[model samples]
Target chain A: MATEAQGESGGGLEFHPMDQFIVSPLFGDGGVAWYTITNATLWMALAVAAVFALLVMGTAQRQIIPTRMQSVAELAYGFIYKMVEDICGKDGVKYFPYIMTLFMFIVFSNFLGLLPMAFTPTSHIAVTAVMAFAVFIAVTVLGFVKNGAGFLGLFWVSSAPLPLRPVLALIEVISYFVRPVSHSIRLAGNMMAGHAVIKVFAGFAAIAAIAPLSVVAITAMYGLEVLVSFIQAYVFTILTCVYLKDALHPHH
Target chain B: MATDTHSSAGDGVAAASAPGMPQLDFSTFGNQIFWLVLALIAIYLVLSRMALPRIGAVLAERQGTITNDIAKAEDLNKRAKEAEAAYEQALADARTEAQRIIAETKVGIKQDLDAAIAKADAEIAAKSADAEKAIAEIRAGAMDAVRDVATDTVGEIVTAMGGKADPADLAAAVQARMKG
Candidate 1:
């Protein structure tokens, strides 16, 4: 379809795959302002609304025998709840709500982005970075607040020899700070790569000879992206739980 | 084809002239981050206040209902067991009462049988004694009558065959012959 549009305009098949990631003003063609309701804003709001519909309105009745939406909502709730408890222990379950919100937002954004013309906010490093930074900052603050100066004990390797302890501590500190970068990049890279690859395949479909092969490749990629989308969300959430565990128990 | 190439060239120039990469374009980062934080805060509030509590309540309520139902079932089972025990006790009592009645009946029947047998024996003994007394009286009377007849016959024979003799002497001879 894209190639046909280009052909109609007397253009040869030229596809700019990265153009899809552009964040433009939803209302006007002007540059995005801080208050401008961009496509990212709309999709992010939609994700929140989706979570509300499933978790709040869907479970409004709280039926003993749950409806399909309620079942989904409860399943999500239990899934995140169990993850938090298992990873962070009972004490850390107090923060289950925040973790649940993060999971729902990311997963919903990913699944919604799979729509033909939809925007995936999670594919942008800016969005994932903010979430990762928030987790990093919050856990670090909580670690100190809860454990006092002993929070540094997280970096100290008691098992190592006394001479090697300082080196191990430096390594641990660097890796600890690197968590947010890796965490953000993992999600954004997976989502961005899958979408770009699909677009490239779609562009290849312009050729009559390879059109069928392009379609098959797109189909396969789409399936993999579906799995990737959910898995990435789960990975991000579980990692958050792990960080929270570290904050709660710095001794380990 | 000419128009397609023209538009394609223009798109390529526009793409090149545009910012390096939209992701790297920091001009909009401020806007995106602001909205993202706003959106995330809104989501967190809604989940914490409205959605999560509702879900938690539902789960807690379901758990409570299950436990209550189980407790009620246990109570009913206990009552059923009690009722069964009572039924068994009543059955045992009835069996005992029936056995007592059977035993009493057997003893009463035996006592009545023994009393009847004793009364019949006494009546039979009294009747047999009266029969024996009557037979003895009849035998004594017949013996006395036969003796008197024999004495008269002997006196007549002596008077017909003898010469003149004293009545006393004849009588004596008869007596002596009879004796001999």
Candidate 2:
């Protein structure tokens, strides 16, 4: 067995599963500078292209009875449109284009990452944090700009006892600040964990004794990851809607 | 041999010295954020300007067409209902007219029959009266002739036997015998 041969040789079975997520330069062996195109850039560009093809080219005909691709594009549009409307009310619907763009990019990136040897830009904190921070800054600024000092009322707990109000307010402020952290981590963590688990299973497939089990585990994890991919995208978008709602109506 | 060692050492450095998680690396955040914003802006433009308007137009057109078709169908249905009622009313009117004509014809026929019956009755009465008059006249004439013949015969017999009879007496005797 290869395991036995590796044992006889000094080197052990060295399968670096996290190596798949390395942000190396795409062109040559050069280190990734700030501007050097990398795997993340390529996949991000592909995600953008996929979104364009689905939303723009797919619906170019604008048939009364939509074709299959058009149906998919319309379904995605209506899905996010309804989500924003339902969560943030009519006022939040104006920002639907931004939310829709965010959802399409994340979902397409997640889906493309499932392809063989594909990089998932969404799995990186660098990518997800940018989106999360953007949402955080936008909602915070909107809250202050729209509500002025009344935005601080979002932290005030009127229902609590007068003695506990300050403590509860503190907790609310902490949680409010934690929103971006949790938002960014939730998507990136779920994606990174699922992909890492699959890579680990694939590593086990080299052993003859447990190769079949490893394949089954990979299949199951892949199925779960597919669900996670869509769900994480949905969760990220809905949370953005929730924050937008808070910004729009920060009374409670 | 030196190149091989260097490559192996580089792999070793990457595996051992690198951060445990690549996500914690903040160096590439600028690039990812820059590109993400660009891509997202492009998507937003495509959606807002191109895709959403087209889809909205199609949906609105379909709704308009459906509502218009429904209204047209409803109008046609109302007209059909009015036509049906008008047909029923005309049918009833024709039936009543037919009944009135039949009744009038029957009354006219009855009046004509009554007049004809009266005329026949009058003509029968007139003809019977005429016949009775003629019979009466013939009877009287016959009676007179018989009396005359009796007188002549008697006178002739008398003459033959040299005896003359009275004509007034013969006539009165014959009339009295006929009466008895």
For residues A1-252, write the lDDT of model 2, one tens digit per residue.
233234336443334456566666677766557677878888988988898899889988888788999889888988998999999999898989889989998999999999867889999998898899999999999999999999999999888889998999999999999999999999999999999889878877878898999999999999999999999999999999999999999877
Pairs clashing within candidate 1 = A10-B3, A10-B4, A11-B4
Candidate 1, residues A80-119: lDDT per residue as tens digits? 9999999999999899989998999999999999988788
Which candidate comes out best when scored by DockQ? 1
lDDT of each: 0.85, 0.83
Model 1 residue A186 CA deviation (Å) reads 1.1
**Candidate 1 structure quality by residue, lDDT tens digits, B1-180:** 334334334444433444434676676688889988988898899999999999999999999999999999999999999999999999999999999999999999989988988888888888788777777777767655654554555556656676455656755666566578
- List runs of model 2 lying over 4 Å from the truth: A1-14, A159-164, B1-17, B84-180
Residue A103: error of model 2 in Å?
A: 0.4
What is the DockQ score of candidate 1, to 2 decimals?
0.30
Measured on C-alpha atoms, candidate 1 has an lDDT of 0.85
For each candidate, give the interface RMSD after superposing the true interface residues on Cα.
Answer: 4.4, 4.7
